[model samples]
Target: MDKKTHFDFVTSIGLMILSLVMIVDSYRMGVDVGGALYASPGMLPMVLALLLLLTSAMLLKRSIRNGGARQNLAGFVAWFDIFRKSRMAREMMVGALILALYTFVLAPRLPFWMSTSMFMILLMAILKATSLVKNLMITALVVGSIYGVFQMVFHVPLP
Candidate 1:
C-alpha cells in the first residue's frame, strides 16, 4: 500500500479503538437515576461513540474501495516536504496549538482577557513577529475584541 492508504488504514484503526474506549467508558457509567436513556449520564458519550464508530466505518469502507489504485507514495512525500518547508504553515500550526491550549486548559481558571492576551502575545512572539509596537497593538486588539464580544455583548462569565 502507498503512504496515503497506509495512513488512512492506521487512522481508521485508531478511530475504531477510540470509539471502543468511548463505548466502554459510557457503559461503565452504569445506570442513572431514572433508568432512562435520555436521562442517563452515559447518553451523550454513547451517542458520540456511535457517531465515531459510524464515521470510522465509512472511512474504512472508502479506503478499501479505493484500494491501492492511484495513490503515489512519492507524491505524498513530496507534498509533506512542501508543508515541512513552509514557514507560514509552521507558524499557523504554532498559533493553533497556542489557541487550543488556552481554550482547553488555561481558560477554565484564568480570567478571559488575561489568558487570551497572554496567548496572543506568546503566539506572536513564537512567530517572530517584528515591531514590538505592532505586536502589542495586534494582541490588544484581538484579545480586547474577544473579551468585549463574550463578556459585554453576550454577558458570558469569564473564567
Candidate 2:
C-alpha cells in the first residue's frame, strides 16, 4: 500500500473508533430522556456520531479497495516515524495537548477568565507568537473584553 492510502486507512479506523465511543457515551446519556428522542440531551450528539460512523466506514472501504489493506505491520511502524522525526508534528501534538488540557482540565477547575487567560498565554508562548509581556497583555485584553461583554452587556454569569 502507498503512503496516502495507508494514512487514509489508519485515519478512517481511528475516526470510526472515535465515533463509536461517541455513540456509546451518547447512548449512556439516555436517548429516551423526557420520553422522546428529540428531547434527549444526547440526541444531537448521537445523530452526529452516526453520521461520522457512516463517513468513516465509507473511507475505510475506499482505502481497502485501493490496496491499503495489503500493508504489513512494518508499513504502519514506518508511517509513525514521520511524527517522531517531524518538528511540525511535535508542535501540532503539543498544541493539541494544550487545547485538550484547557478544555477538559483547566476550564472545569478554574474560573472561565483565568482558565482562558492561562490557555492563551501557554499557547502563545509555545507558538513563539511574542514576548512574555506582550503575550500577557494580549491575553488580558482578550479575556477581559470577553468577560466584560458577557457579564456586563449580556448580564450573564461566567463560570
Candidate 3:
C-alpha cells in the first residue's frame, strides 16, 4: 500500500470523526442558527466542524486517486524516525510540549491575553528568534491584534 495514501486516508477519517463529534456536540448544546449569528455559542464550532469535514473529504478523495509517499510501511512503526532523519526534531518536539503546557496549564490559570503573549514570545524564542527586542515587539503586536480582534471586536470571553 502507498504510505502517503494510507496515512492521508487515516488522518482524513480521524478528522471526519472529530468534525462529526463537534457538530453533534454543538447541536446537543442547543446552538442553533435560528438565533442571532453573533450570540450563538455553537456557530463557530459548527462552522469549524463543517470546514474540517470538507477538507477531510477532499483529502480522502485525493488520497484515493493519487497516492503519497509510496513505500513499504508494513514493519513496526518507527517512532524515532524524526530524530534519525532530521536535526530539528528535538526542537519541534519541545515546541509541541510547550504548546500543550501552555494550553492545559497556563491559559486556564492566567488571563488569556497575558498567557497568550507569553506563549508567543516563548514560541518565537524557541524558533530561534535572535534579537530580544525584535521578538518582544513582534510578539506584542501579534498578541495585541489577537486580543483586540477576539475580545474587543468579537467580544469573545477571555479568562
Q: Give lDDT: candidate 2, residue 15.
A: 97
Global lDDT of model 3: 0.77
Tens-digit lDDT string for candidate 1 (16-89): 99999989889777543447677788889989999999998887777767664235334456667877789988
Error of 3 at 147 (Å): 1.7
**For model 3, where is the 10-residue window of minimal lDDT?**
69-78
Record all residue pairs in model 3 with backbone atoms less than 3 Å apart, i.e. clashing. Answer: 4-68
Question: For model 3, how does the per-residue alpha-carbon lDDT over 25-104 read when each residue is reduced to its tens digit?
Answer: 87755544457766678878889999999999999778766644232222113423635467688788779988998999
lDDT of each: 0.78, 0.88, 0.77
lDDT-sorted candidate list, best first: 2, 1, 3
Candidates in order, TM-scores: namely: 0.50, 0.63, 0.50
lDDT score for residue 89 of model 2 = 91
Instruction: Give the per-residue lDDT of model 2 (tens digit) for 23-70.
Output: 999997874465677778888999999999999999889888877465
Better of 1 and 3 by lDDT: 1
